[model samples]
Target: MPAATPPAPRRSAPDSRIRRMIRIALRILLFGLLGAIVALLIAVFVTASTLPSFQDLMQKPNGQTVRVHAADGTLIVALGPSYGDWLTYDKIPSTMRDAIVAVEDRRFYSHWGIDPVGVARSVYVARRLKAEGRRLQGASTITQQLARNIFLSSAYNYGRKVREAIIALALERKFTKQQILELYLNRVYFGGGSYGVDAASRKFFGHSGDHMSLAEAAIVAGLVKAPSHYSPSADPQASVDRANVVLDVMQDAGAITPAQAKAAHPEQVQFAPEPKQNSVRYFTDWALAQLDTLVDEQTAPLDVWTTLDLKMQKAADDAIRANTPKDLQGALISMENDGAVRAMVGGTDYVTSIYNRTTQSQRQPGSSFKLFVYLAALEAGVKPSDPVTDEPITIDGWSPRNSSRRFLGDIDVRNAFALSINTVAAKLGQRVGFEQVANMAHRFGITTPINTHPSMVLGTSDVRLIDMTRAFASVSNNGNAVTPYGILKVTTTDGTVIYQHDAGEPRVLVAPYVAAEMTDLLQTAVNTGTARAAQIGRPVAGKTGTTTSNKDGWFLGFSSGLTTGVWMGRDDAKAVPGMQGGRNPAQAFAAYMRVALQPRPVEKFQTDVTLPEWQLEPDDEAYYGNPDQAFGNEGAPQEGDQPAPKEDVAPQNPDEIDDRGPPAERPQRQRQSDGDKPPQLDQKWLDGVLGNRRQPQPQEQPH
Candidate 1:
């Protein structure tokens, strides 16, 4: 004790103070190490308790993926979790793997999941950036990212980081580095509604991940940070820039040589073509709306097979874009005679307006409504050769004028329909009774309300384009009723059928003979009447409809067993100057059919009845003005027929608007001199008269 006291007395004060400080620091360090160990244990316990089922994470996605496909199995759009083929580590291209590792975590191979050096560097940089008023950057390694993507929510916080680190460490113990990497690549989101590198590779490169080039691999690897922002389809320039950064990182990480990195120009990458017809969204939306009705609760992924024909859809979109005027909207719906919808374009731009004019909008069908009136007359035993006066007539107080303002006084029922004579349509509606006309419309699939007003004969009632298309499809289907459908089948990924379109026995809507007669009249209309613009060098039966104010122009026709309807108008129903059914609408129909029908053989309308060619009549206004001086008294009302009412609205003046074009554009009927032969279906004369007699291509077959 005396020796120790002497030694302590001789010790320097500074040395004693330093020893005390060292002892305190050692104690503090020891406590800190113990505390960290305890905290890590607690984090491990909590993370393990909250971890997702490994089997489920490996086999099942969180949400069901709904893949909508066109009739030919072309992918239209993917709705939910989009995962491609599960690629093994070997199946993944080495370039793609290296690019991901280089960009995401340079020390991925050397680190044991939780990279302390990377974490320290990331923390330092984040603090430095935070002090400069920047957003904090994360230090998630590839293992951490996989853990978060598969097992944890993407919330940034200290607790989430702790959990991610614990999970990452556990993943490192459970799987090899390559296994972790394979899982990571298969689970990452790569934008464009795609998930996983393989899906993204196919989506962007039109091939699997195994075939990716260096540039493509870099581009795909760069998509992980901010997928939407770096998407090649959304922002090509940004994607290229980000991909170059990935290449630089790869070179720095020694995954790629500098020369190789420099040679890999992502800007020159040829990405897959963008989806052709955005109009397919319209059909997809429609099909999805009916999905729940078709199947039970969607608990698993579904593979939907829709009736949409991609080629026909593109053709329809192109036709509408080419023909629709600026600021005006157009809609088209095409279907098989059996009512399977082949194509639909709701508007000029779907992103601008999603309101489906084909099914949602109801507009007056104009003279196209005459289809029901004429059909009713035909059902009532009126022959196509029956005499019908196109002269001015009033029903109650409504006086309908011919579009040309000058009527062909004594034409047969066939020519009357071909010329779109309003007076004759009105007289026929009255002759067969408005109730019968409305009944015929309902029978032909007009679901909207049809007022039995006298003026309704000129298509005053509002109808949907789909309804009109379906009605015409019924006529094209030899009088069988049609219900328009878009979905062919819905199945699961395992090839289990969920819903199959049951094309049940068609309901007989009209007599085949009556439909044939109406088809003949419609053919005559297209061949020599207002709808000559709709000619496709084939026999087509259709009608033209122009509403009172030119607010709606429509052409509903059928060729080669397909029925299509086109409508042009403003959403506000404002008049479009000089708009007519036989003009833009018919032209659009022709344009679409030119492509839609290219794959099909020409089909003639099958009918037992044929109309004999009529003798040409001169414009004898004086002879037609006097009813008694007409060709025959048959043009007058028969026994028990209702009397024609006096004119209420004055005959449309020469300047009045009509379903046909302006007065100046009206064709002048060549006067047949007393000694001249009757007019024939002269090709040159018809071309000069109708101004549109060109033949388009053939027909199309639905896949």
Candidate 2:
């Protein structure tokens, strides 16, 4: 009672102090609550606006795809850096499904669009492991994986994790679990420039994803965990170990029996043949470059179906690889007149380096570009028999000389073309209008830059290898210029028809009559010109080009059903000394064409019904000296003034090829480097045809 009385007298100060403290605490708590409310509102607004649709990203358009083959299910070339196309969920392999599920989320099917338990367990495990000084681990479900690949950066952070969650919810709302899983399967990286499972399967195993074996599926799935770290093709043991881990997880998750897991373990990881080692490395590399200019990234396929005849290609590749000088380089291309890429070889190897001298290098075409000049002259009513001078002439201080500086004063147009006389081409170009010749080349599908100067007649203009192939195709297609393509159809993941390649009516760049005359000229070259090296037993026509200093050499030719061109040069435009197109490139072309025609009937040239006026003058000088006398039964041309030939000679057919078999087989080819060993003129390309399915180890691509 006494203590209470004393407290009562003096308790006001204590009571007042208590009240002040309580008020301050309340104010601080209230402000924190207000701040949190503002932050929450901002976050909600930002998330609402920042969220994106998964479909939009999944559908990016690619343009003007150069398929390098027909739509009939062949693929020789692609348009983008990624060598792949998209596929749908139904085609996914069960092995891949189980493997990924076991590794990424054991209870994925049971989760209700989200896996809270998985996340919690992962956090717990992560903490335990951290305590034990181990690496961190994840607990992402398939939906989460899809969310991350589709909408989030690969970088790990708390903020990104939260965003991934929000996006995962959005994805769940838009697509079912199966659909999400499908997207994840198709979108995951599998190393080796492959973006999706379909591409991964084709690129690594040379087959469809649906056919992947359990071991293959495990390897593919394991790559998702650490693509560079566990790429089987690059690091076999590491990849196998990761695959084993996948098997262990599958066993733990009851996805596979222990026996199944053990059986699925890889004894050795075998990779699909790398392109660099392909016999058609140069051809493929060149075709790929052209496809890049034509097709867009999103629309290209994982497996490009090409116009290449695998059998023919293999033969050509083998012959060239066996015959070419080990240190020199060469390239070859083949296609049907309808723009189907039949075969190609950039160099001995295509894996380590992909620089295709055939398409990318702009070395002089030598005599190859003369086809257009001769064609343009034919269109101008210049007869094959007309004589022209092969004497040296100067244009803008540029004097043109022949490979052998001796001029055959008066030679027929056919003989000139066949012999690839530089002087005659220069003289003929002056009469035909340099611009007209350039335009004719453009019409014939020479999409590369063509120099309008008089030197254009000397093949001085830069031309890509594919463009040359297509140009030659015109002769085979009866004057129709057919654009080349590789992919036949491209569909979205949901089966929406994204693209279907359809051949348009032929563009008549030249009259069939003119094509016939051109064909005859090329035939003459095959029969008697430098292209003699290109002669096959069947009726074949081609031109051989050996530029000045031997910087570049070319052989462009065709048969009734197919057209092909070969190019040989250095990447730096350095002269290859004595190496000419007829040496390796032309021989490769001949080798490929020979086999390509074996399965089919021998080709026959189709001569034009209407022949141009034939002038029997001995040389261009004689024709120029007396233009009136040189007129044939058709008399002088009815059109513009007859432009007399300068000091030059006649046009000739493709120089009759030596019609020789491949150069005596040089040293047997070892497994060539993946198209990376300095563009060797190695032999193993599509044996000689342009369109051959690469026998991955041995089996065909689709089989």
Candidate topping lDDT: 1
lDDT of 1 by residue, 508-551 (tens): 55556567778989998787677878999877899887765567
Off by over 4 Å in 2: 1-147, 150-190, 193-306, 356-361, 489-500, 608-703
lDDT for residue 284 in candidate 1, whole number 0-100? 88
lDDT (CA) per prediction:
0.78, 0.65
TM-score, per-candidate, Cα-based: 0.56, 0.54
* lDDT (C-alpha) at residue 596 in model 1: 92
- Total clashing pairs in model 1: 3
The per-residue C-alpha lDDT of model 1 at residue 166 equals 90
lDDT of 1: 0.78
User: Which RMSD values do the candidates have, in order?
Assistant: 17.5, 18.5
Inter-residue clash pairs, candidate 1: 597-698, 597-699, 597-700
- Highest TM-score against the true fold, candidate: 1
